[model samples]
Target: MKQKDLIAVFDNDRDLVKAIGTLKENNIPVKDVWTPFPVHDVLKMLGRESRLPYFSVAAGVGAVIVTFAFLYYTAVIDYPIRYGGKPYFAFPSFVVIIFLLTILLTFISTVIVFQVRTGLFPGKEAEVPVTGTTDDKFVISVGSKEGLADEIITEAQVILSANGAVEITEQER
Candidate 1:
């Protein structure tokens, strides 16, 4: 299925953010934003939040608990050891390994989650919506669906130009 999109290109992040705000104020839906670098303000304005941090935290905690449990079971129940009058379940010794394993598991889980969520895998090419987006340009795209009114597009273009869009073009995808 082919879709029509109105793209507003900005030379800087400030203009892009400002244009997005204006479009929001006018109730124009912004489909996506492309920038050379991560724009925290733009992500907030778009209400885009990542679950990676949350998943990492959970993974770390789970790793710690599981690591501790496995150590305890092996040392105390599975194989009892009495060396140098030390206790079978030595918590002090477990600390270092537990911390290391937690970091390792958390990192692995975070990477896996990120890759899965982003659809990034081997032999897959990324889709670039507009040119110069990965350079210094910022792009704001508004999607046009079936029965979309031309008046809305015109209004959006007016808003984009007024808010410092360097160029506004229509593209079919």
Candidate 2:
């Protein structure tokens, strides 16, 4: 089933934090937060683990393993070719190929993983819940549930305004 969502925009990290704190303090459920650049203490404010770095590490490891395996299989088993008196399974020479392959694989894999995880990819229309959120602004989104969207939107508007937010707007989808 398609899920409905609400997006609320804020002007800065300070206001964003205050809005989030108020929501949590009042037992509101925030689905996610979006910002263009890193915000100090934002994760702590939201009580969220940093998943992007973990995903990057995993992608790097996978890239290394895949590069090593492909080079190993091609050089030692599939079609061994000796050159310059070096052994068919020359480990030193393989280093260059492995390193290059690892870098390429890592970059591509990381981008793909990030896109999938964040629902951002080519051909997908960009969703800027709040235009300013990507430029010195912050956004908080709450999933729409039965009989709760209006309440959440209202509370968010009030909390954001009270916290010095320059502007607040509710977006429905």
Best by the TM-score measure: 1
Q: lDDT, candidate 2, residue 127?
A: 75
Tell me, by lDDT, which candidate is best.
Answer: 1
What is the C-alpha lDDT profile of model 2 across 1-173, one tens digit per residue?
A: 34456566777677787777887887777777889887756688777756777777787788778878898899899999887998988899878887887788778877777788778867997677767766877888865455355666677667657777665554444
Q: Per-residue error at 58 for model 1, in Å?
A: 0.9
**Which residue pairs does candidate 2 place in steric collision?**
none
Instruction: Give the C-alpha lDDT of model 2.
Output: 0.74
For model 2, the stretches where C-alpha displacement exceeds 4 angstroms are 1-8, 43-52, 142-144, 149-158, 169-173
State residue 125's C-alpha deviation in candidate 1, in Å: 1.1
What's the residue-level lDDT of 73 in candidate 2?
96
What range of 10 consecutive residues in model 1 has the weakest lDDT sum? 142-151
Candidate 1 collision pairs: none
